[model samples]
Target: MKKYLLSIFTLIIPIITFAQDSTAEKFDAVFKEYTGWFVEGIFAEIPFTDDIQIPWVLFVLVGGALFFTIYFKFINITGFKTAVKVVQGKYEDIEKHGVDKLYGDQTPGGNVFETIKDDGADGEVSHFQALTAALSATVGLGNIAGVAVALSIGGPGATFWMIVAGLLGMASKFAECTLGVKYRDVGEDGTVYGGPMYYLSKGLKEKGAGGVGKVLAAIFAIFVIGGSFGGGNMFQANQAAAQFTKLFGLTGDNAGMYFGIVMAALVAVVIIGGIKRIASVTEKVVPFMAGIYVLAALIILFANFTLIDDAFALIFEGAFSGLGIAGGLIGVMIQGVRRGAFSNEAGVGSAAIAHSAVRTKYPASEGIVALLEPFVDTVVICTMTALVIIITNFGGDSSAISGTFMQYGVEVKEGVEITATAFDTVIPHFSIVLTIAVILFAFSTMISWSYYGMQGWAYLFGKGKITDLIYKILFLFFVVVGASISLGAVIDFSDAMIFAMVVPNIIGVVMLSPLIRKELKKYMNAINKKEDALEDGATDLVDEM
Candidate 1:
């Protein structure tokens, strides 16, 4: 597998490098033309109302999340404490059926003994590990660069809708992750295989909607595979490489290609080991990187504490007043919600692929845990990024700096640079630190997403070491391609692919919601009964012990 991957990588690199140079020049020309066309189109039709300016896609996502929220009777909110306890194993007796034991001294897939030996008990990685793995994918450049772009176009008001969109998204996360565990397939060797693919196919089949289920699942898998290659893997490496080159003032345009190769090589090393290794790496990298970035944001926030109120006022005013450029209030809201959805991906169903690998028996346990993702990624992290930019502009003529294409006063050029500028404004030399943070965030996100895409590829094709290798190789190749080239088209296509997963995933979730409800009831009942027993025993112990 390694030899085959290396051979493919070797052949692809030079071709990608040459193609990227040509593509970049072409992209610059086309992007300029397209931006004009896009802006004209926006003005032509959507005479933006603040409330109505939000895209139909955002409505679908937010509405879907709201539906799940009500359908599950606010499980995302009500189950938070229980979810934490489950992750801590306080409710283990309710979730685990029996004592977990690793296969005892047996070879891989050899016999019953081997199977037993490999069939490890539940809780492979801790609930925190699972959360970190999922977070690693969602909390990347989108929170940093993407939010800056949104705020620039949508004005400060975008931040308000971003938070609203994120809050509602929690329910959607709950639904998909619940189904992820509910229908996860366990292999004979105790290897776990699960995701939206398994649940969508199996759950719908159970509901006697087998044909629809299979078709939707297949479509989702295809998009997921594409997304893994494009947005998740390539886009990450591309952005990281670009930022790295920029920070060091690397000269040759092909520097990005070289950086991509290094990034791809590192990814190949980790992914070759499969989910166990991927999960382990993310558990460490995600927390460390997130902590560093958040701590830095916090420091900036404190340094500019007096400006915080003004930032909030501007965000609220811009969101509702539609006083800036673009289509109006609605356009600003659309930009924020659209970007937020893209960032955290609550309804898109990609995160379920990672969360499904958890060792828990109760699918709802993971569902409840999954809700925390959007809060952390969009609500907390993205908000901090937005606040930094807003605070920087406080008491200044932000409109003077707004670029030609931007609708609001926020600047559009060099999003990462703009963010770094904001940081540097408060703390000199912070740009260097932010550049490093961006690289780490991008790398961690790409690796985790590579796993997501591989699972989708295996589902669509067949599961084998060969198939896994093919997916990883292709994924790495795209990383280099994304780094070296102007990938507006590719990113657009992948962005669509990511959103496209929403329809089928939501269909499967809605269809299988009854099953999720059933599981939730079963798990909750078990918890209730266990608590009752404990209370009764405690009363008895008062007389006995």
Candidate 2:
């Protein structure tokens, strides 16, 4: 741990020294151009029409989501109630088997075992903790900045398709997370290791596709590691540092760099303890940040209750008609789907890593709970942000052409800035509050992604303590780099790496989906039998009364 901390300082000192030597603008320009060149090919778009070019990655994600929805017989809709019950601990007392070995031998002196064990528990955390951890990763910048950017570009109509994509994405989340749990590795010491990596390799090997599984798992691990550095660590730190500087009126050539160092240090404290620590923090932070952000949005919506109907009217109209946006209907739909996938991350298979650690014997139980991620992230929180933006119309021109507005004599840009403007318009000086929310959102997301990327790193490079420590240190360094550098190319490369996971991940999911269906059926049977037994007990008691 000391060595890891030393490594972080070693990386930071040189970066700060270099930033001191060069002007910020010059540094940013070079970084952006270089990064863009490296990642442009991977993130290249496929032209569907003259004006509607969707990234091939988005197509892979959307296609997998749609296929899973049909294959699972719309489990997203029919299993919603079951998901809620599972997360609420309704089935916690269900008898668990095959875990006696997890408990060590104890002398028969009426003494309790001091060592904590799963005791038939297959995972490390509760259902709710697992869901919150996954939600923390997905429900961050995408809900704030991603939504604002989409609405600005696609207009009010884009909201309609975003919701559509989220609904279908629930099925995709269920499929991958179920596999995550089924193929997971449970150490004798109660450590849990699961994700696309394990499922792709282990699960596929069980189906006589060992060769293909090994290749896919390797590719997924590499992409996941890159994504953790770029999208999960750096991009998040960059946005948070930018927002913090803007809110406090901080001015300096290295302001962002300083902020990134501080942020990285804080993140290092949480990540050093591994997933258990990350889950514990996220369980608290996800609900608090999401609740505060949502409550604020609700207050804004309630303040303008009269315009609620009008906002919905515009959303539906713009979605179908394009409402004079650059690309028309097709463009609006593309924006909505693209942004929705980015925000909820249904087909990315990253959530499966988080959900796989859930303390449940039934893998499908976690899968059912996993479906709620997209619903809460996109359908609920993101919708609130879009509504706030649409109702305020950004406090100025509502036109879609420019995608910019004026606020207090300042040019309101896109992303979180635009969302912040919408909040400030409804309640004066609320930008400060929005700024805090963005920071919390970024912090929670960075820590969660660190765990995710570490899991991948461990899988590929041997799960030694040394390897884990090195990866964590490298991750923290990227957090600082993301804040200090204006690497458009760097961020693009990382974003592409994240999207690239969808290709190999979905292939594994598609092949293993039949097994997921079997697990779902087994889980449903247990739930139904329990319900029936409870109903019979209630009837007998009523008769006695």
Candidate 3:
């Protein structure tokens, strides 16, 4: 596997050297020109009016979320308590109930091969690790850069819509992740292969939509691989390298390349260990990074406690009135929904990939927990970031495109830099801390995405050691390319690819949602039973006393 990976890396070395050596100006144009069409196609908008054009994919996401929210009778609200308990391992004993189904005959085909018998649980990772792994992927730059971008265009009103989107998005997360586990394929060695690729194909086949499922699965796999390369690998590496260079005053043509190489090596070390390793690393890093960032936001909020109510008022008002922005009400909604989807990643089906790897007999257990992602990511974390930005920008000129005394002091600032500026506003010299957070966010996101992309790669290619090694090397190469190249078009294309996943993912999810509801019912019943048993035991103990 190592030799095969090395041979593949050798093949890409020339391309990397050429890209690295090429004039930055020339390659930027070349990259944009080559990749421009994909971006245009994926983000193509429908003209709702002379001034309003909404991307169709955004509608796809919103529509699925709305449908699921209603169909599940607002599981996002009803399931929240269960989700919290599940993540807390309250029903840990129930994990054993599903070991037979996980390792035994799951489909009509039965066991693909004799797999390892596990005494404790049938999954590769615990529920927390899966949640963190998925969380690490979504709760990165989007929570930082994307929130700032939305606020700049959509104003405070965008924050309100973002929260609404995140709330509705919970149902979508529940549906897809439930299907992820239900359709997952467990190998003889206990390796789990799941996600939209499996559920779209396998679940659809079971539902008599075999041909549709195959095509959607293939398309989803292809797009997921591209997404992994663009958004997951390169975009992350590029941003991290950029942050590192800016913070330390690193300069030179090769600075980003060097940074990318270091990141690639670190990522390679973790990803080579597969999901278990990825989960372990994320379980630690996600909480730490998120906690620090949230803590800072809390401090800022408290510091501006008097302005909190007024900031929310502006958010509500701006959302409806659009604050006289270009697109008005429609525009703010688009920006909020787009950024919300980008941050929390509901309906995209990526979280389902991570959640599918959890140790539980009831797939719905992870599905319930999966709903927390949007709440934590967009509702909690992104909201904190937005509040800080809004609060810092308070009492300043509302008319200026970019207000004076704002972080960048211009009409527009770069992405995550806006958040840094917000932090620095209350706490002087906090940009250094923000920069570290950004790098950690980027690093953690890349590792998780590496796992996501590799799953797609493995699904498309054979799930062999050589295939895995080859994908890892190629993925590492993209990390370097992403850091060094200023490929606006490429990044745009990759962002589109990430959103494009919603199409097939939602389709499969919509079809398989009934199955998910059934699973949810079963899981809930078990939870009730467990609670009843515990209550009875408590009552008996009280009587004896």
Candidate 4:
């Protein structure tokens, strides 16, 4: 497996390198043309509302999130405090209580912090570590660049729908992550393997739909692997490279290619260590970078304090106004929801890969934790990004920025550059800081996604050292390819792959919701019993972290 992956990597690297010099312009032209076709052929036809056109992917994602929100009775809302407590180790005993009983000498399959520090449990990382890993992947340039694009096309009204979509998405995240932990597999060496793939296949088989479940799971795994390679790794590198080169005024055609090689090398070093290393690095990087970015956004907001009320008014007005600055109410809503879904990845099921590594006996515990992701990524971070853009254009005519005049339906102008301009408007030289932030965001995303893709790769081939090495090598190679060459086609296909995972993933989550409900009930009962016993002078079961 290692040799096979190495050979493929070897072959692909030369092609990518050669293409960088020989076919760079050709590739860019082809990709642009392809993107136009994709927009017209597929994206244009999807209906956003009963009367307006939107992408079908948006409907699937939003509708699924809404369904999960109702089915779970708003666990995202009810369990928010409990989720914080669980992550803080307040309910550690409940998660660890039945572990020894279930597996005896062998470690149970899931514990939240196994990745950061090994303890012979099913968990591959701490709850916080897992959260960071997931966040690193979800909260990338999308919040900065993608949100700007959405606001550009959808208008300030889009921000309102983005928040709505994110809130609903919390429920979907909870459902899928709960299933991820509940149906995880623990290997002989105590290595934990779980995700939508495991639950979709195993959970369905348990329900007497083995054959169908296996096929769907296999398809999902394949797409996930592709997605990890393309959207998760390559596209991230590509964008980061572009930003870096643009900031430095690197004019040569091969400048991005040169940047790609450096980025790929850095990615390869971290990915070689697998999820444990990736989680460790992200646990630190995610918080630091997020703190910096959010702080900058806050500064801009405070500096432009008077515009806050106006921003809100515009957001509301634009959201409901029958005549949007561009399309209409539905158009803005679609843009907001699409951007929000893309940024937070609530229904994409990528977070399941990270959540599966969490150490917990009760699956609902992680589900609660997972809900916070969309809230933070989309509801909070993406909102801040939008506010920066909207607030920057507060006094100006918002319609001027809308891409309605362009033949290719409305799009944002230089989204990354627009975001940088917004930041620099308030804080001088902040673009330098933003460029650094973007690079970190991109690198962290690539590393975490390397683990996600590797899991799928391992599942398809085999979970051996060789297979692991192969996947990482191929994944790192793509980082360079993504940076060096134009890959809009690859990015589009991979974005679709990521979105497509939602189909089988949502099926598994819905199918196994009963089990999730059962686990939630059991965990709640344990918590209640513990509280009762404590009132009666019983010893507390929680272990201090």
Candidate 5:
């Protein structure tokens, strides 16, 4: 750890030496041009018609999600109660402590000894912590801002489709996270190295596709690393800094530089402790941040109690009719599906990395717990944002276009502010609160992404202590850089990089989905057996009494 602290200087000295006048200006231009080209190529949309187009990645995300939903027999709905129980530790004896006399110090096919010695509690965090860690990554701007953007273009009808997409996404999360834990490696020191990289290579290799799996794993690692830096860390920092600077009446792009540095320092403190620390922070911070946002949305919702029915009516009617929306029903559906899939990132597979650290013997148990991510993030929190917008009708009138696309004296990136204005309609001066929420959202997002990028970095660079140090230094540097600069293209490229992960991840998940099903069955059977054992023990006790 001393070596880790000292390594900060390794990055700092070079930045200081190069912090001259025109150098920063020259480098910014070069970075934007290079990233812009990548963004254009990666995010180029498939032209469905003159007025409507969608990215192929969105198709992969939504389609794979739908397929998983059906393929799993609506596990997202049926297994939801099981998922809640798993998080609440209802099956603790089944997963951790063994069920005595079930199979000669055994259970679950008489492998209790092996299960306890080899796999019992091989993880670093609790089910709740793993869920929160993953949730912290997805529950930020997407729920608050992206939902608003979808509603702005697609109208109230988009909310219906959004809920549908989020439901489908729940199954995708389950499949990938199950595969994540099944193929994960737990070190002698109890550190976990898992995610799509492991599952693609290990799980697919088990299916005799070693070459394809390795290539896919490598692609996933590269994309995740780039995404962690760009979309997950830098883009989040940039947006939060923007909102903070604006709300506080600060001027200049560099006005947020100091703010960025402070935020970076805070992130550095948390991430330096690794995933356990990250999970610990997230388990607290995620609920708090989400609670505050949800509570405010609830206030607006209940205050306009009369508009609730009208809001749902608009959502249902607009979703099917889309009369005022260009390209009709398809456009509204596309926007809602896009926002839903992107918000919770069900098929993107980053959540699997966080969920892989859960303390469980059965891979499918963690997978069940993982499915709740989309439920809380998209279905619940995002729906709150959508309802607030629909109820307020762009926070002004019952019109389609509220000039929000042109408001705020800037281009239509009014996601955070738009949601803020909706809340302010009832709460008054809630923008200050909203700004703090955005900053906290960004801060939590960056810390989790740092852990994600570190995992990817370890996959590529090998698992030495230096790997953690080097990744931390670079991550912290980007946090400051993101806040200090204004590079739309760079941010866009990063967003594309994040979506790029969907390709290899979903391919792996689909290929290994059969194994996922078997694992799920294995887990459920054990759950049943455990329940039977408890019932037998209870009957024996009553008889003895």
Candidate 6:
């Protein structure tokens, strides 16, 4: 693995040397040209008639979310208390050990592969670590950069739709992750390898659709690898590189390439250590980074408290009347839903991969815990970021484009830097601090996504040191290329790939949702009646004790 990584970096060093004499624009143009077709095809509009069209992925995501919301009876809302308690370890005793008298006591799967068995739970990481690791992936650029891009394109009206999408997404996230935990494979050495690839294949197989599940699983694995490269890896590098270069005025064709190399080197260190290492790092880093960014956002919001109502007024008014918008009503909706999906990734199924590693006996427990991601990510963090930008008039003069989001004086190229600019308005040189947060955000996201993509790669190629090395090499290569590309190409590809995971993921989840509902029903039943159940399990506990 080390030799392969070294060889790969050796090949890329020329690009850095070659870039010295060229302009960055040329790199962007070539990237856009080659990959443009994939982007166009994925985002192609499906017409409703002569005048109206929407990306069909939006329907897949929203439709599945709505179905889940209803089918599960709004588990996203009702499971809140359980989710909190589960994360706080209120149910750790039962989750780790056993409640033999419960609704349906699941025997831990760790015994299946005794080639190696670790002590404790069947799963690898704690619930909190799983949540933060997953949170690290979804929270960063989408909240900081993607939201900025959405507002710039969709206007304030998009904020309303963003919140709506986030709410509906909670249900989608719950179903996918519940199935993830239910169908996961615990390996001999205690390593976890699961995700949409596992659930779609395993869950559907149990539903008597084995052949269909196999095909869907393969497609999902391929899409996840691609999605990780674009949305999870490249888009992150692009934004971080853009912000880093802009802050220090680092000009030249290779500025982004130089930044990408450094980031890739840093990322290589942690990913080589695998999920446990990744989890340990993220638990500490994610909170500190998120706190710093959120605290800054809160301060800005308080300083401009008077504009809160007005900002919201614009959001609501723009949602209904997109008069100055490009695609008008539908355009605003697309941006909102797209960014919301991109931001919190409720239906994307990536969280299922991370959440699968959580140490819990009940599948629904992790799923319940997983629902908080969209609320915290999209509803809380993303909303705060949006409010700050809107309150500061951060996108620029709304009338500049004769009523578009073409904010005068704002540089869209910098992506996440725009958020920093909004912060700097209330606090001087805040972009400097923001640059640090962006780097950390990008770093955390890249590491988590590396694990996700690795899972998919292992699904397709079969897991081993060689397969892992090959995937890591390929992944790091994209990180560099992603940084050097133009924002439009990078973002278009990123959005297309990430949302594409929704296809297979949503199909399997919706079909398998009944099982998830039962899982939720059983888990909640056990939780609500734990006292009596625990009393009955005293015999089992006595043996272990």
Global lDDT scores for all candidate models: 0.76, 0.83, 0.83, 0.79, 0.83, 0.81
Q: Report the C-alpha lDDT of model 4 over 402-515, residue by residue, as the tens digit.
A: 332221135756778778888888899999989999999999999988888888888889888878877777787788788878766768877777877877787777778888
TM-score: which candidate is best?
A: 5
- Candidate 1 stretches with Cα past 4 Å from truth are 21-54, 98-124, 323-326, 397-413, 537-545
Candidates, ranked, TM-score: 5, 3, 2, 4, 6, 1
The number of clashing residue pairs in each candidate reads: 9, 3, 3, 14, 1, 2
Alpha-carbon runs more than 4 Å astray in model 3:
1-15, 23-35, 98-120, 396-402, 406-413, 538-545
Which segments of candidate 5 are over 4 A away from where they belong?
Answer: 2-28, 35-37, 98-119, 252-254, 394-411, 538-545
**Against the hidden reference, what TM-scores do the models get?**
0.86, 0.90, 0.91, 0.89, 0.91, 0.87
Kindly list the per-residue Cα lDDT of model 1 for residues 1-545, writing each as its tens digit: 67887797788777876686566678656755655553333223333444444444555677788889899998867987887787677755435442122111234553442233232235455567778888998887888788888888788888998987887788889889888877877666566677889988888888898998899989999888878887787778778887898789997867888888888888888888877888899988888888888898999899889978877887888788765546567777777778787789998898888888787666777888888889899899999999888777554355422433333544476678777878788789988888888898888888888988888888888878778777878888888888877767667667667777887888788878878888888668666766665665521111100
Write out the backbone clash pairs for model 2.
Answer: 35-489, 36-489, 157-319
The residue ranges of model 4 lying beyond 4 angstroms of the native Cα positions read: 1-14, 22-44, 47-51, 99-121, 396-410, 541-545
Superposed Cα deviation of residue 324, candidate 5 (Å): 0.8
Candidates 3 and 6 compared by TM-score, better number: 3
Candidate 6 C-alpha lDDT tens digits along 1-545? 67767788889878656644445567667878998997887778889656458877778888888999998888888888778988998777667654433223426752332232333458888899999999999878778887888888777778889998898889988999999899999888888898999988888888899999999999888888887888789878987887788778999877888788888888888898888889998999989988988899999999999989888888888788774777778777888887887688888899999999988778999999999989888988888998988887733454322222336223265456667777888999888888888889988999999999999999999988889988988888878877875556656776677777888888899889889989988777767666665556632231121
Q: How many angstroms is residue 158 displaced in model 6 relative to the true structure, after the best TM-score fit?
A: 2.0
- Residue-wise lDDT of candidate 5 within 1-545, one digit each (tens)? 64654566466545633542466667767887767777776777999989889888888998898899899999999999999998987876557643342322333455434333332567889999999999999988888888877877787788899999999999999999998898988887999999999999998899999999999999999999999999999899889988888887899645657776778888988998888999999999999988988999998999999989878887888889884776678888998898999899999999999999887778999999998999999899988998887676543545443433322112246788778878888899988988888888888889988888888899999997877788888898888778877656667777888998999999999999899999999889878876775666632111100
- Show model 6 residue runs off by greater than 4 Å: 1-7, 15-37, 48-52, 101-120, 323-330, 394-417, 484-491, 532-545
Question: 1 or 3: which has the higher TM-score?
Answer: 3
Candidate 2 — worst ten consecutive residues by lDDT sum? 536-545
**Clashes by residue pair, model 1:** 49-330, 50-329, 50-330, 53-330, 103-116, 103-117, 103-118, 104-117, 157-319
